[model samples]
Target: MGLHVFGHDPSGDTALSERALIEAVDVLIFCAPIRQTPAVISHYVAQAAGIEREQLWLDITSIKAVPVAVMLTSQAEVVGLHPMSAAPKAATLRGRSMVVCEARLDKWRPWLEDFLAATEADCVRADAEQHDRIMALVQGMVHATHMAQGAVLRELAPAVGDLDGIRPFSSVGYELDVAVTRRILASNPAIYQDIQFENPHVAPMLERLAAHLDTLRDLVRQGDDEARDRMRETLLEQSRAYVGEQAIAEGSYAFERLGYLLADLHEPRYISVFLPVDRPGSLRALLSVFEQRGINLDSIHSSRSADGDLLFRIGVSRDGDTLALRSAMSAIEAEGIGRVVDAPG
Candidate 1:
């Protein structure tokens, strides 16, 4: 049976078809594949022919201004919500910010408040124009910039042994770029494309930046110090204008918070071997042995090493000594399971 937690809708009511959605729903939430379609509102309106003005209409589009404009004439109290969590494969409402923009927010304010609070979300109230303008930079421009970097790297990677003398050094800026690139390469590309096309302002900004980057690259190749200096100063000035020193300080605070969280969940240390096994079911057999012996594990990380061995770190359970754990592992024929050595010390 279908349940209605908030409203008085009957349980076991058959699901409404698309044609009947507008009439059936007390509130209509429209989520599109992309945020910036001009036809989105008209489409919703037509689908919802008999929907009353008293019914709540909402869209969770990233850029809100266009949706708000379309819904303004309708009798329905319209609101736009943007959830600010970094998208996981399947993200739920938890730990996400839902920014809301409303015309006549008072009418649906209670329902909105109740819905968001249930999910433990932070709610920021803003209007259509303000929301879109912020997103133009936040999603659209940011994605475009990273895409450009990825493109450049793909095009300009050096051949193996080409940089034998070049030392690898790390800096905050490089670390930031690493994080940015990691996100870009790992995520879906369509999301980036949607951000570009959805927001009207994104394309032009990306184009101008791309042009400037090309010019800068040319200047560097030509050994033009004057051009390079000017470009650097302009870029630095823009960065400062966008996010000041205080913003960096705030980021540091967030980093420390993450460190504290890690410490709170920290476990005792032990190690595991990640070598390849000729026999299947080796990992299971080894783990079973530990289980049978009542030897617990702490934290474990496993990855492939450069030499083609599986590398693993298994932290010892707080209650067990290393010797007992090693003995359990030995009974499983740890070496035959491709472990190089038992309890490397």
Candidate 2:
């Protein structure tokens, strides 16, 4: 924690050249995006040649095989690290598995393991090829499956302008799927593309998936009860093997949370108001309007624009207060207090 951190950004004002940065640091960590990882590592690795044997080079790329192979060419000790979770929160990282692939030597392993343990992450030692193989299923196949599902939904159903339209008939599993699908779709598409294209094993995995889907389709078309029952049992057994008992056990609690979320969605929604920073006591005045109506605040987030206008996103929930919220929002809009936007369901 006390270590002095120096960053080199090529486009920034305080940019240090790659050679300078390489020479200054004992440990060089490449945190580049998947597509740029090979080139970035190679560029620095070339510069770092014959510098020092004590220097340790590492990469945190999602796909390990290629990057670890490239890193192995470097004179310095190379370790391939992959944090399993995206944008790791405390709960996600703590006791979570982090794959560490040994490419070259044991010198940096202890330090890396110590650092991972300090963050409460479990270090999983794996070969680069093994890591990539597992990732083909973990990342590649999973993403492809969701992408296919989303595509099917778009082709079959009406355009989903509002997510709320589907909520009424949705199960807890559907809600979870939507949440995960949205999260994946919101991320950089290039990263997912790299995962799909870069992993050599993904093509075969996708072929197998397609074959399995075809089998399922044939089973459905045949309408043979015995065959269908066997297929169902096989699917469940395979799922249990993949996710294990813990996920099955936690599903009840997940459903309970889904119930609470559904109930909240049915309640009166929030109005996100963006007010000018120059207007003093505007927030207090708006709060008073809710207070007068006996409505309670649910949540609030504040940010400032480039022009210094205050963006206040407030959440208000009521059991049967939609009309009241609408009237209050109309009044606030009329007063030129702020522009009010409906919060998404």
Candidate 3:
């Protein structure tokens, strides 16, 4: 039997109308939209006063401070969670980050940890104020930068093709930006709207982002040796120094890894396969087919298909034997392990 759920829709602008959501569960999580989050929590809190049980309250919003504060108004244990990722297409949040803010936790900390553990997310704890301040740069400035890039690209669509059409000439940086911009555009506009407008720190953060951009524009116009030196000093050297060496090293390594992945993805010689069974040894069995055929993979990445199948994209080396790759695909299907959804012609 399926588990009964009692939360309001995250996409909805309205607050919870039902009191059962408050009385029915030990934890009242308001998944409602950001603009209406307070009202939703208020509805729960007003009804919650009559109940005697000490419950827990949590929210999964991007910005935490306001929600955490509102949640604190209740007599319940309060915590705010921010899953720093686009919605998951898979079951687990293993590779994704989940920020936890302990606002009024006493008995709820263990419960929160248990819940987080089940999600398999990389959990980090911070206070509500600290979380919002950092999100100002991470979410606000970053989103604004891409949004501006998207608008500029939209304007240039008449000369160059829009996002899809411009991909043929996209550098790795441009390609990555395009992907992020597309993701933001595709999601609910309200979420982005609230992130920019609601977070108190965002407005000031945007000003700093704009100032740096304006400085960059002026430096490019000057196009002198002094301008070049100033650009490096302000944009590169000083910023790098402030960022710290450990962070710089980590970020540099991450970029290299992504670069390698992108290079493999761009390869023309690759095959997309999907295993039917959702069990252990399925992937091992599939990989063994390639290994047996002496087909060395250039890159192997997993993603979900349109129908929610676990699809694996395997990139073959340019100098590798195409016949072996074809045989491997056939073997996978014949062994009743997986089917090749895509392969080079």
Candidate 4:
């Protein structure tokens, strides 16, 4: 068994240059941060002056398309691998998945299988482009959406530095929210950035996401019963287009289990805003200002504070011009009562 360590070049770990390493090895395993794959590959190739194409080259990268493309063109035979989990302290990979792409199964099947068997991992094959596209939605959009929610929550309550055990939260919904928060908070920013930006397929996925939200926002502002009904019909129709009608029905049923009514209404999305209110009437006073401006109350939810203030989620119909609505709300004399927040750009 032959192995070598390649720490960061500046960290003073003594290792051969890229050329020496590539030329001297029969099997080369390249492991670097997801964003540093191109740089590492370039350096290794530059140093490997007389290396032949017969060497077994493998890269463990988060996104596979770009790396696979680069490796396939190199002199060496390549196998793209993505380990499904990252554990710095774990001793064995008992239940891990190794995503493999562009594998020469006919030539190296036994060697590859035996390597995975020793590590106790299952070798799952996938197409390079397909894997990245799936990951764009699975990792990119999901993480970005959760980060947006966490940002909205923080803007609502600037005082609460952490949310380990927040109360008055729904049992099921709060548990899911906590999981989302933890997942995003524990991740590296550069990894998320590469996942979002590297894959070409992600641009269209994100475009569709923004377009869907814009449609929903516009529908909420119209507020006509007929228009709201039409919007629901359109949304259900769109969902059925992707998932079958039965699947759409099943999803609607599942959503109900989490206490969501799924009513079609033109209500402004609310974020929890914490501000000082002397009494119950103070909340009502803010509501009166909105009511006077022809904003109908779709829902008004509240949370209490230790100093007698209440955090109100005043959901009102989005009517009139957006600028006019903001100006009207800003004119309220009560300092720090509420503010209209801009969604993530």
Candidate 5:
């Protein structure tokens, strides 16, 4: 990956203007913010009009419709990309997803796919309109829901202290709601606003959401169990139709898994060991085995045994080297310090 990458900041260095930079590169990629993407792309595209048609132009904007449309006007081959992740982390891109909208691809398709494969990122090809449509629901509706929750919570809780105190008594679901709300609120407002406003499908989706909320309120107020049951059944049936019965079943299982994963008490488990707490420094000695082997323990809990001896439960996450964990566990057992109680499937 001996790639020479250059950054062109408008205010920082006026020597290499955007137009000059675009003319110099084989591929011009616009990684500007969502709101500024279309404008930035347009300005560069105008300069690129007289350039060779073989030049490839791309944008990695969250909202694809506008930038894709602008890029289409240029003489260069246009490819709209949206990496379904934040900025690059380290040199590896494994487990990351990149969306590609081939507005006008020729040879650029294979080149782009090969480049993504080298980074080990999953590339998904979609039409520009389809991508924007899905994003409207995926991003726009989701953000709006969180924003609304934040608004209501601000009115109800009113203070940071209240939120901190409420956390101890709240369920994982409530905690997740607050987390999502806060995550959205913490981001740049203009980005979210552009996502919600630029997508034409979002307004209608919001309207439908409003209507659904109103209907649910009415149903709750009526206190009619029969009507509520009927509504629930209808909604479930519609959901099954939309996503298929198998998907519904899988979604339920995923929800349960998510609940367990999100729980404060649940540690990422590769191995769980039960150690005797009666001996002085037994816990420290047990942990030292793992430490010596370079295996990290995520959490350790202690409780009194029925026989009056103390029991220590040590947990290690899957991220710890598996071979090292096994070796450490064997050493602990051989030393008469602990027994491996459970190992992750």
Candidate 6:
């Protein structure tokens, strides 16, 4: 744990011999831009480059098959790591998903497993090929569909209404879809660009998605009972049959839970607080202030602010007296439990 870590730019020269410096380290992790990733690892971590058998080479990239394959060409113990979420405000990947592809691990397997366990992530083991294929569905198809939805909304905004104007008339499903679409549109384009193009499996997945959409469109255009029966048979019956009972039940339950959370978040009355301490009972102590004041809370959620502070956002019921809620917030700050921040809109 006390080991000093150094960052070296592979393209740039060091004053001392570059090969000497590289050969000195026990681990070499590749974190360059996506397209140049394979070339960088392949160049530096090769068996001919004096990389030792005990050395570990890891890469934290989205796609795995190619990079892990290239890494295996090295004599070093090779591993491919993919954290399945964006860089979080919190330090560790606790409660999030991570993919671990152990291509050629032998000497460093125990150490790698320990390091991953310390991160508290929900780790899934996959071979490189399987990882790429599943990710094509989990990431690629999901992003593509939402991007398409965003485009359709943009195209119709002039004829229908803009996001803000349409909000008043939106149903739960529409609102949820719009939130996801807007989130994808708001983020950097390059991440999505690579997910869509870099993975070989994504193109085929998109074709399948397009085929289904096209069939739905045709069925709708027919506008008859026969068309309705066909739609039910192809879309609902086949999908439900293939998806199985348990998964369908869980997915439907998840949707209902999301719907409830969304409704509470949209409520007008809310208070956002940040607890400075990082220990047990911090949240409970903060909640007690509201309990003592007899204010009814609709919902409570934890999220990270733009400035990277963890915020506990409380949605208040409409019946909650504003003055009483304000009094409780002031008490919380005065007692050094937490600080009240401006509630998100």
What shift in Å separates residue 211 of candidate 2 from its native position after superposition? 1.2
Residues 232-297 of candidate 5 have per-residue lDDT tens digits of 866666767989888888988987776765652455565556665456787778879988998866
- Per TM-score, the best of the predicted structures is 6
Q: Give a tens-digit lDDT track for model 3, residues 40-82.
A: 7787678777571488888988888888888888888888999
Better of 2 and 3 by lDDT: 3
Report the lDDT tens digits of candidate 2 across residue range 214-248.
Answer: 88888888888987786887666787778878888
lDDT of 1 by residue, 1-345 (tens): 132523222235446555566666777776665543436666667666545577887776777777777876567887877887554232246556788887756677798777777656678888778887778778877777777776765665454322232214434454456568768778777667777887777777777877877877877787777876877777667777788789978987887765543443344356566546625676676567678778877665554454545555666666786677767667656446556343546
Candidate 4 global lDDT:
0.66
TM-score winner between 1 and 5, please give it. Answer: 5
Residue lDDT tens for model 6, 19-100: 6656667887888666778888777765336545678889999999999988888788889999988887787799899999
Count of residue pairs whose backbone atoms collide, per candidate: 4, 0, 0, 4, 0, 0
Which 10 successive residues of model 3 have the least lDDT summed? 1-10
Best by lDDT: 6
Error of 3 at 256 (Å): 1.8
Worst 10 residues of 5 by lDDT: 303-312
Where model 3 places Cα greater than 4 Å from the true spot, the runs are 1-4, 9-17, 160-166, 306-308, 319-324
Clashing pairs in 6: none
User: How many clashes (backbone atoms < 3 Å, residues ≥3 apart in a chain or on different chains) does model 6 have?
Assistant: 0
Q: Give the TM-score of candidate 4.
A: 0.62
lDDT, model 2, position 122: 74
Which model, 4 or 6, shows the larger lDDT? 6
Q: What is the C-alpha lDDT of each candidate?
A: 0.66, 0.78, 0.85, 0.66, 0.77, 0.85
